[model samples]
Target: MQTAQRNSLKLLQWMMAASLALPLALFAFASAMSWISTSEAADQEIQRTLDVAHEHALKVFETIDRSLAEVTEVIRGMSDADIVAREKGLHARLRVVAEALPQVKSVWVFDANGRALVNSLVSPAPDVDFSDRDYFRIPAERDIGTYIGEVLTPRPPYLGARFFSVGRRRNNEDGSFGGVIQASVLPEYFENFYAKIGREPGSFLALIRTDGAVLAHFPVIDHAVRFEPSGPLGRQIVANPLAGARTLQSPADGIERRMRYQRLAEYPIYVSAGLETAAIRSRWVSTVAQHLIFGIPATALLFGLLALAYRRTQRLEEEASRRIEAEEALRHGQRLEALGQLTGGVAHDFNNLLTVIRASVDMLRRQDLPEPRRQRYIDAISNTVNRAAKLTNQLLAFARRQTLKPEVFDASQNVRTLSEMIATLIGSRIEIAAQVPDESCLVNADAGQFETAIINMAVNARDAMDGVGRLTITVRPVNDLPSATTGPPNPHGHVAVSVIDTGVGIPPELFGRIFEPFYTTKEVGHGTGLGLSQVFGFAKQSGGEVTVTSDVGKGTTFTLYLPRVVGEHSPQSLLAEDAPSVDRANASVLIVEDNAEVGKFAADTLTQLGCTCVLVENATHALEELAVDPSRFDLVFTDVVMPGMSGIELAEEIRRQGLDLPIVLASGYSQVLSQQGSGGFELLQKPYSAEQLARLLHKAARSRRLRRDQAPAG
Candidate 1:
């Protein structure tokens, strides 16, 4: 059983571990995947930002080219002479187009010699020398489609916001290089658009020319910080010119970032967007922390349950082991104790009986004994023998082996009759009261044992009251009484006879043991402790029960519940019997007993009562005498238990052979008689007087003759 329990606990512990472990394991895997996903997400975000910046740069360049084309159409087929000639009207047209664009600060028309013909801010065509500017110088050196100039704040006489210039080379009708069509682009316009993209902290965006000049930056730089052409990002850009991304340090802020760059389709311009590595890491950390917050406590709770179960299991095993040892020790002590008490109780009571018989016999040996004194001594021995017999019966009663002769009798009247004798038994100091119902409470039980039970209870009450308290005996019919053993209540009624006493009551703790034999609370000589046990056994054997209720300082009530038999009875009166007359004239007796002396004593005693006596040591010898003439002996008087073919068997054999002899079986206490029954024979209990033997023999013989005379002829 313990092993099964441990196995179950182990199974439960494993289940608990698995229940939490499975989810936490999945959560841990998910957290790792989420971290990787965050990193991938950071790279994707950077690429998308770069795309936005790339598109914005393309749109700015497209506007610049469009404005330059309109101006070129206005100057179609015209020289620097014609361009200066239409300069006023052209200046108004350039200013009208630049005013339409938020990003275009101004526009200039310069000839091949780098002399400005028309400009948007000063309409009369200011004499701005653009030959020194990169827009003009780069285009003059190499016939490029368009040249992107370095960012510059307009100096004196160049009125507008900070801007970079986009310039296109013009061709003559013969396809020779013409002057540059210059448009000033505002850097703040792209900066405002990048800021509007709403990147998180530590992120950066920029519009960069392939030549490593930053046109626009977000957050816009206060000081001019040029991009490194040979750094990590720059080297990557040089390796893969169109588009690339890498983890690199920012040249402006020196922060590590994942930076991506994309080149616009039609221009020598690249857009770069970078996200700080630390910010990406923070996102990954936040996801992992959430999983930990939920999983850690659940894991702890699983282990906590296992620890508690382990502690409880260990404690139970230790306690169970101790209990086993204690129970073994208790059982051993009880066996030895029970045997000793049984022997002591029988020996103690029998020794008193022996003392009486011994003393009386010793007195009978006196040579000068007077007749009256001899009779008294004889009576003492006789009474003591009866006492020894009664004590044996009391032992059997407690054991529930006593053969009972039951009759239906009124329980109320019985107790009332005993009420007078009870006063003499307990004493007059205690008040006696009897409460009996008008209807008789009849019960089929051994009258003698019932009376004995009542007397035992009254005696105990007297002792409890210390000889001076109220004693009440009540008898009434009851139905549906609850069983004493805690079984279902009896629907059939019972007669309840209660003996109540106003004395220091029984303590509740001692209620269970009060019915155990030789277990007494009285002083050593005052009780044999068989009284209540006799009550217990008698009630049980009679198909009834006994119960008790008590309060320590108030009183106690002992109730005996017997199955009530349906009957009406006239009130019974106690009667006394005179000395029985014995007539054993012309009687023939056959005695079968195992003991030689006891057989001889019976035969000799019957011989004095005028009976022919035959003695045998066992049933075999008695059968030998009966084989000669079965009818010669009037009665077969035998002991019930013997060595071989016991007296009951012998009597059975005689009846089988159709003998007319009557069988009279006797014993002080025979297992066969107590258990099987008295087998249709006159029973004379042993240690009997000659008069008892004589009376039984005459009765058996007379009964046989009467039966024979009553037989009809065939």
Candidate 2:
């Protein structure tokens, strides 16, 4: 009878548990259903905003271009000299035309020499030169139908506010490039219209040229700011859709938003509108929170009834077991529920990634897919893999304390520019003072690692100050080491970047061990103590040193001294690979890859490309193969990261042995490559395609042949 009672009690407990979970289950189901609907609604709303912005931009641009055409007719038969003779009359007419359109600030007719003959704003046009501007220069190069110029500030006679121009080129008697007729476009016209449109808080509105130049923006943007064609939104715009909407992070401000963009039908301009992602998420969360608020109390009530019933039917012996079992089941249910939510949240991003791969794969499976389409699909897969590799790199880099890639850049500018970011990092309670001279203090080191070091020190300083104190960062060139007494200074001169904080300073007794790896005074879960160690490691590796001076409860200063270099870096452009890539159809390649699978893939891919290949698992074997026959291979292609000897080290060894073979190093990421950059060898970044491999191999082999031919006779 007692056994029966226990079984009955157990059944009752299970029923109550199920009842407790019912409300939560309903909430979860409701949340899941609403998520998709909510996201679609958000996208639709943004699409509507984009349409408004696009219509406004089109109308404004159309008006400006039309007015420009009308003004151009005024000087159709007249040359610059002829226009100059009738300047006052033409100027009055131009002013009349400009006054008719609020979007157009002024109209001007410029000669081939960029001299303003007549302008709407002023007669004689203030003698301001437009020759150097794109509007004047582009038309001078060719008889462009309508040229849209970059944002520019007008000279003396006009307001200094920014304006873009729509200009048409006039042909000379010989049909040669002549002068320009420009209408200065008012950016405020777009901004004011954008303001009138109803949008969610933190929405963004922008008008941009197809070439990735910003013409105007709603919230106002820096005139010089431009987006890269490679960014997410840029890619979408380049896809040449009539209109599209998606979520992406803005390149200018780094705010993620659900954005929609529409292109002007006849023009090379695209207008974009976006609602901030955080706002959308907040709205969804509010809905979910309401469900949670209603569900939780009901769940508690069911559990309370269960607890009361269990207490009433208790046999102390079985009661303990029942409680433990019931608690465990509840905990398991909670964990499962948490897991479901996490999966639901993460699935969105992963599904998007998978969709790209899956669509590409499905296309590949087509029986009659065109070669061009096939190649595009292949490229898409490769790109998606590269994207996944980057995500993986972030995790690995965090755990592995990834190495640096150094560049020659000004340290003072980095400090000054990073001050605002640091302010965001440390909190508003902390006052930041940055001291960087106008003169550049160039250093040969990794800019990223330098930034990481600065961030670490700033974070530590923030904590030391208890989030409210003056933090000063000073960057200046120093020849002598006043603080780094323990180490010698860089004889060439050192750039001393110091982070000083008026806070609860570090105890001097701990200074020696502070730079030690995994040795942190910060409470557990706060830090792993790798920050200072990394800072110290970077300084030493760059042939410099770090020093710290602290007073207990007073303040502390951490200085990083790096070897200074004496030059500015000329900007390097990353242009796309030339068409009809170089090919070495029957060239011999030595493949050095550590992974069996990767090595097999490289060998197989090269073979398919009509290249004779030899696969080696390590640098030692590769060197042995080269030693056996020095000129057997035309190119040595190796992976960057490896056991025993790295690809970089192998390349150096091959050179040391005086082998004439050209080496192409490949990697997704590596310490040496990151620190010292390509090392003057041709580098093929990992996740490359067969075409990329073929092109690089051909270049390397061709280089080898050239070197041999150019060498003095043996």
Candidate 3:
């Protein structure tokens, strides 16, 4: 009987091992499949984002082009000599027409000599030179039927405005060339026209110039404005402008995103729109996480039932189940950990994307659209951009990319302004008071960041006061005094912004560690513990510091010390140079550009500015052009990056040929220009407007002219 019992025990051990093995294999297979599906879903989400971006971008291009074409037609009508010679009578008629056209920021007539004959903005003045402007020269070249220039920030007659000027060459009644008729339109004219687009909270649309400068961003103030890609996806799209829909992880918040972008065929512009996956597929992620967590255990229970059925006829199966239980628990924990990491990565990318979209929208709002139809479309665009901004703020608050935009401003005024907002923020549970002096105290800090810091302090106070508290904010000028608790004397003049709360004070021991990232005193799900860290970061970034003064039951006061600017600091204006005369006498120009648009623009611009332009695509082409007739070209205008050889290489080749053709290398990126710095050659940035192009060509042409004039006349 004893021998029979030992054999049964061995058999039970084998059964236990088999039971664990069967469920383990099934669970492993299920986990792999789930992860693969999640990854594929993430990729699909990215593609969808790209598709949306492309459609929105295409719309911006079409709207801008169609509007310009319509304006061109209008200009063709005004080009009549009867209208041009009437002068004052024509001005009265134009004003009547301008008032009727809301999109027309300004409608002007230029004489054959490019002198302003009638301007809608002011009484016709000839002070400005239309001859040197792009709106005049670009259409005159007729290289492209229509054009869209880069966004120019607030200038004369258009304060804090961004608009595209549409132009067409005018002709005299005798069929001779008149000059040009032009109109500048703000995108707001089209804003309401495109209001049909339904964009999610975190989605955005942007109208970008060919060279990558943002022509118009939705939400103007909230949208991203930089030409190059800001986050990872933006970088990828820029690297390959022709890319269709694609997915990318943004570094700003580490969220997986979908982007759609398309370049306009006629204009040098692209319109793009994108959506965050979290906003679009939040349900999917939640479902995936839920099933992965609960499905395995439930499925395991089903397998256990099968095991019980097998053991029903065999009582010995229960003796060796400990090892099986241990293996199952370990495997389940492993799968959960993997899922967590995957989900976290996806969330981060989503948050980063929202941050960028919001910033882009903000930038877009800054654009001033004048065309009624275009402005209506842009208004719609602005709405979409604003939604994108709201989405980003949430994501940034989650991912901690939301930093401060500090400017020197009066501290007391800021505190006083926050009075109403703080009251609304704290609700009826907290009473707020501002103890600020009337004298102006300056602090270099972001108004929003300051408000957030105050809100956080108020919340902490409310919590200490057990959901009720009194909050007092004070601002004062800081002189040569050691801070409330500092070891050294103040050097930089400072302003003290203090938030005092009648709440349970923080322990002294926890003071130094409170500002550590992710360190929170609140319970789980209550906070991410980044509030104080953000406050700390804001202070440090503003060239200041945050100090705390608190006693066990004496309440807490968080004081932010910020550097004060002496007197005042105003924005410096770019030094403007008088337009130089185009002296092309005997100047020959060598133009190298791989892209036809840029190369043609440079060459035609040079020729117009009075130089013989020799066009080439690469270094080899330039060398070949020079080999045939070395003296044909006097100055070489080449792009830095080319197909066969670079601009630097081509310059070297010219030096080897013993030719001193003044070389002007143009590039879009500053890095390449910096690399060729001070090499006795001038470098011009690409996507240069007509005036800039004219200026650079003249500089090169005049330099060559001087060299020739100095040399013995051959």
Considering every candidate listed, which one attains the maximal TM-score? 2
TM-scores, all models, native as reference: 0.41, 0.43, 0.33
Q: Candidate 1, overall lDDT? A: 0.80
Q: Per-residue lDDT tens digits of candidate 3, residues 54-133? A: 56555644554454455445555465454546556656656765665666566677767677877666664445666767
Query: How accurate locally is residue 373 in candidate 2, as Cα lDDT from 0 to 100?
Result: 97
Sorted on TM-score, best first, the list reads 2, 1, 3
Alpha-carbon runs more than 4 Å astray in model 1 = 1-30, 313-714
Point out where model 2 deviates above 4 Å.
1-4, 308-714
Model 2: worst 10 consecutive residues (lDDT sum): 570-579
Q: Which of candidates 2 and 3 is the stronger one according to lDDT?
A: 2
The window of 10 residues in a row where model 1 has the poorest summed lDDT is 570-579
lDDT of each: 0.80, 0.79, 0.63
Please list the Cα RMSD from the true structure of every candidate, rounded to 1 decimal place: 30.3, 36.1, 44.5
lDDT of 2 by residue, 220-338 (tens): 76646687888776787667566777677776677887877888878878788888889888888988998788778878887888788777767563655667778999999999999
